[model samples]
Target: MPGVAERLTIDHVGQRGDGVSLTNGASLFVPYTLAHEIVETERDDEHPERRRLLQIDTASPERIDPFCTYFTRCGGCAIQHWQPDPYQAWKRQIVIDTLAQAKITCPVDPIVDAHGAGRRRVTLHARRGSDGGLRVGFAASASHAIIAIDACPILDPALDGALDAARALAEVLKPVSKPLDIQVTAASNGLDIDVRGTGPLPTAIITALSRIAEAHKLARLTRHGELVLMRVPPVVTMGSAQVTLPPGSFLQATAAGEETLAALVLQLCKGAKNIADLFCGIGPFALRLATKSKVTALDSDGGAITSLQQAIKDTKGLKPIKAEMRDLFRRPLVPQELRDFDAVVFDPPRQGAQAQVERLAASKIPVVVAVSCNVQTFARDAKILIDGGYKLESVTPVDQFRHTPHIELVARFKR
Candidate 1:
C-alpha cells in the first residue's frame, strides 16, 4: 500500500538542491522544494527516504514559477523556481562550505553569471518507443525513460534547430534499433551534430544520414566521431585564433563560460612570461592566454592537440605555443620540466587532477591557477597545493550551467 499523506517542513536545500528534512533520525529528500516551506507529500514505501511532493502548503518567498514546463520532468535543471539573488548566493555558499570541510580558508568571490545567451552545446538521447516511434529528447528525472521535447529554453538561440536536426538524423538511424546519443554544438560556421551508439552502418544507411545532414544544413555530421558527412569544418572563435573543433571534442558548456574563465586565468597570470596549460582541451584558455604570454598547452586528446596546432598555424602574432598530446595522469610535468614556466594553469576534468596535483605539490611553480567543475575535487586539490607551500589567494565560482547544481570555479594560488 502507498504511504499515507503527511505534512513536512523542509529544513534546507541539500547540495544537490533537494529539500531535506530530518525524520526518525534519517533524511527525507523532496524535489522541487525550498527551505522553511511546509509541503504535503507521501513517502514511497519502497524508497522510504524519498517523497513525492503533492502540494506546497506554505510556499517560501523565494519560490517563483519555473520557466520551462519540463523543469521537474526533464531532470536538466534544478532550483529553477528560486529567486536569482538567493540562488546565486547558494551557489557561492556551496564552494564556501566545501572549502570549509577541507579546512581551506580563503576569499571566495561571488558566483559569476556565465550562463550567457544559454548553453551552446546540448546532448540529447534518442530512443525508440515500444510503439515503434522514435523519441528524441533528454532523459526523465532520475530515470532512463526519455521525455520527448521539441524545444529547450536553456539552449542558445544559435542551437534553435539542434533538436530538429537530431530528430531527423535519429529517424534515419531508427532502423538500426540502437539507442543513440546525439551531441549538438553551435559552431561559428553552423550546427555540428555527432551521433553516437550506432555501430557501423551499411553504405546505404550512411548515405541516408548524409542526405539528412544536408537537409538539415548541418556543418558536419559524425558517427562515433568518424566523419559521415561534411559541408564545412565546424569552427569556433577563441580569443584571436579560430579553432576548428574536432568531432565531439570537449568544449565549455556555454560560450560565455569559456570567456569568463579565460579572463580570470589571464588576470591571475598577468605578468607571466611563459605559462604551462595542463589538461588544455582545445586551447580554450591557452589560446587567449597566448595573446600576451607564451603558452605550452598539453592534453591527452590527440584530436584536440591537432586542432590546437592547426589553429596556431593559421593565426599569427602569438608568442609561441607548443601543443602536445600527453597523458598528464601518467606523466605530469616534473619540477625540472616545470621550472621554465613562470605561471601554471590547469583545467582538469571532474575527477580533478589528483595525479598531476600530486606532482604540482612537489614542484615550486610560482603562480598556479586551477579550474574545476567539481567542488569536492577542487577542495581536495586545493588542500594538496596548500600543503605544498602555496598561498591561497582567491577563488571565484562561475555559474555556466544555470538552473542546475553544477558549478565551475577558478582559483589563484601564489607562493
Candidate 2:
C-alpha cells in the first residue's frame, strides 16, 4: 500500500549517503537528498524508515547535477550529487568517526581520488526486452528492472562499447530467459568477460560462444567460473610481474587504486626481511612486496595462488615469493606459523580478517599493514590488534569508487 505524500527537512546525511529526516519521532531516509534541505517524499510502508525523494522543496549547496545521465535510476553510483571537495572530506571523516567509535585514534591521510572515468569493469544485466530484443545495461536502483543504456559516462573509454558487446554476446547466448549477469573488464589486450545467470553450457552453446568471443575479440570468456573460450590468457600486471588473472579473479576497480595500495604497503613494510601477504589476490601486494622482502602469499583460492606463482616464475628481477592455498578463516596461521615473518600485510574482503587479525595480534610481528574496504570492520580489527599492544600509526583513505560512499583504507600498525 502507498502512503500519503509528505514533506520533511533533511536533518543530516546518513552513512549510506541517504539524507535523514526527523518526521515527528521516527527517522526517514531519502535518497539523493542533502543535509538541511527540505524535500518532498512519500513514506514507503514496506520500509517504514525509508522515504522516496519526490522533489527537492529546497536545494542544497553541495548538490550538483550528477555527471552520469543515469544518476538516481541506475544502481551504479551513489553520492554523485555531492561536490568533490566536500565529498572527500565527508568520506574521510567517516573513517575518523568509525575509528573513534572503536576508541582508536590516529592520523588519517586525506582521501585519494579515483582516476579518470570511474571503473574499468562493469557488470551489465541482460534480458529480453518487451519486444523480444536483447536489452543490455544496468539494473535500476533497488530494482530488478533493467535500464537499457545508450552510454555510461562512469565507465572507462575502452569500455564505452561494452553495452553493444554484451548485447551481441547475449544474442549468441540465446534461450536465456532470465537476465544474464555479464561482468566485463577492459584488460590490456581486450575485454575479459565472465557471464553468469545462464543455465548449464552444452556443446552447441559453447561452440557459438567461441564464435562470439572471436567476433568481439574477447580476451577470455567464462561461465560460472568455468572457461568457455580464451583467445589469449588474460594478464594483469601486479607491479612488475604480469599475473595471468584467473577468470573471475578479483582485481581492483582501477589501476591507480592498486598502485596506491601496493605503494603504501611497500612503504610501511620497508625494512622487514620477511612478510606474510594474507588474502593475497593474484599477488597485488605479494609480487610488489617481494621486490624488497621475502613474501609468502596465501589465499583460499588455489587458482589465485597458481597465478601468482606462475607470474613470479615467469617474471625476472623480483625477490622470492612463495604462494600457498590456505583458508585463513577456518585455520588462521598461528603465532608459531607466522613467527618467521617480521612484518605482515593482510588485505581482506568487506567482512575484514578477524580470524587472521586475532593471530596477528598475538604474534610478535614488528609491523602490520591492514588493507580493508570496510571502515567499520577495519576499526574492529584495529581494536583487536591495538588491544594486543600494537600501536595505530596512520590510515590512508583511498577513494577508488568515486561518487560512492564505499571507502577503502590502508592502515599501518606497529608496537
Candidate 3:
C-alpha cells in the first residue's frame, strides 16, 4: 500500500487542515494539499484512510512557499502554505459551521489574529537514537520519530536559546536516556525550564542540572514542577498584576492572545459589580476584571490559586479577589452559588465545561461569557446553555497558535 501511488483531486480542507478526496465511497485524507488541487499520493502504511502526498500535479493559486524549513517534516504546524485571507476565512468558517451543525445560531465575528509575537513557550522531546546519540526537537509528522532541530521559527524571539537549552540538558541526562519532555517558558525574568518523564534523579545529577541552569541563565529549573532550583521566580504579567508562575503552569501561547481574549471578555461583562472567573489560571481574567469589579477566582489548581492570592496581596488599587481551589468538574457552582454574581466567565479545558455549564444554565446569571479552545465541545456546551433559556449573542474566534488547526473563541450569552 505504501508504494502504490494514486492520483486524486482535493475537494476541500477537512477540520484538521487535511485535504479530503472522496474515493470508492470512502474519504481519503491527504496532508499539505489545498482544495481544488490535483495531487499524486500513496496510501500510508500507518494509516489506511490517509494518503501521503508525493507530488502536486496542480497547485492552488492561493498556495505560497512555507517560511519554515521544517514545514512538512515537523508536526507542529498544519497549514503554513495557504494565503492569509483564505486561511482566516477558513478558521472563522470553522466556528460558523460547527455552530450550525449543533443547531445553535449566533453572530460569528471575523477571526482576530492574536499571533502577535509568536508562541512564548515550547515543549521539546528528547530521545536517544539507535546509535546512542541524543535527538532533541519535535516529533515528525504522524510518527513518534523526533526531528532534531536547532531552532523553531514559530517560537517567540524570547525563546531563542530554548532548543540549545533543551539539548544541553538532554546531554546531561543521556546516560539514563529515558525519553524526556522539556517544557520551556519565556518569562519576564528568564526561561523557566521543566523536565518531565524522568522518574527521579540522584543528587549528583541534580547538581549537574543546577549548574546547567546557571550556565543557561534560566530563572528556574523544575522536575515535573517540583523545584530543583530557583535562581529567580519566573513572573508573567497578567493585566495590571504580576504573577509568579509555578513550574509547568498553564499559560496562553501568546501574550497578545491573552489580551485579545480578555478584551472580548471584559467588553461583554462591562458594568457588572461582581464577576466569577471559573477555571481562572493565574488570574489572567480575574486580575484584570478586579480593576472594575469584585472578582471570585475558582480553579482546581492549588498552585495557580495560591499564585493568584499572592498576586492580589502584592498589587494595589484593585477590587477584592477571592481565590478558591475547587474542581469545577466535580463540584461546579450551582444556581444558588451563581446567584450572587452579576457576570460569570468560564474558560474550560478542551473537554469544555458540560457539567459546569449544566449548572450555569440553571442559574439566572445575567451575563455569561464562555471561552474555549475546542470548537466542537464549545458548540455542544452552547446548545446546553441555549436550551436553558440563555441567548447566544456573539462568538469571536481567536487565532493564537497560527498555522495549526487549534483555535480559541470567546462568546457572550444573555438571558
Instruction: Look at candidate 3 and give me any clashing residue pairs.
Output: none
| Model 2 TM-score, all chains together | 0.96
For candidate 2, list the clashing residue pairs, or say none. none
Sorting all predicted structures by lDDT, with the top scorer first, yields 3, 1, 2
Candidate 2 weakest ten by summed lDDT? 112-121
TM-score of each: 0.98, 0.96, 0.99
Is candidate 2 or 3 superior in TM-score? 3
Better of 1 and 3 by lDDT: 3
Task: State the lDDT of candidate 1 residue by residue for 1-415, as single tens digits.
Answer: 3768878999988889899987778889998999999999997765768888889999999999998988899988877999999999989999999999999999999899999999999999999887878889999877788999988999999998999889888888988999999999999989998999999899999999999999989999999999999999999999999999999989999999999999999999999999999999999999998888999999999999999999999998888999999999889889889988889999999999988988888888899999999999999999999999999999999999999999999999998
In TM-score terms, candidate 3 sits at: 0.99
Model 1 scores worst on lDDT over the 10 consecutive residues at 43-52
- Candidate 3 global CA lDDT score: 0.94
Instruction: Residues 1-415, candidate 3: write the lDDT tens digits.
Output: 5698899999998889999998888999999999999999998977989999999999999999999999899999999999999999999999999999999888999999999889999999999888878899999999998999977888889898888889889999987669999999999889999999888889899999999999999999999989888999999998888999988999999989999999999999999999999999889999999999999999999999999999999999899999999999999999999999999999999999999999999999998999999999999999999999999999999999999889999999999
lDDT of each: 0.93, 0.87, 0.94
lDDT of 2 by residue, 222-254 (tens): 997798889999887777888888887788888
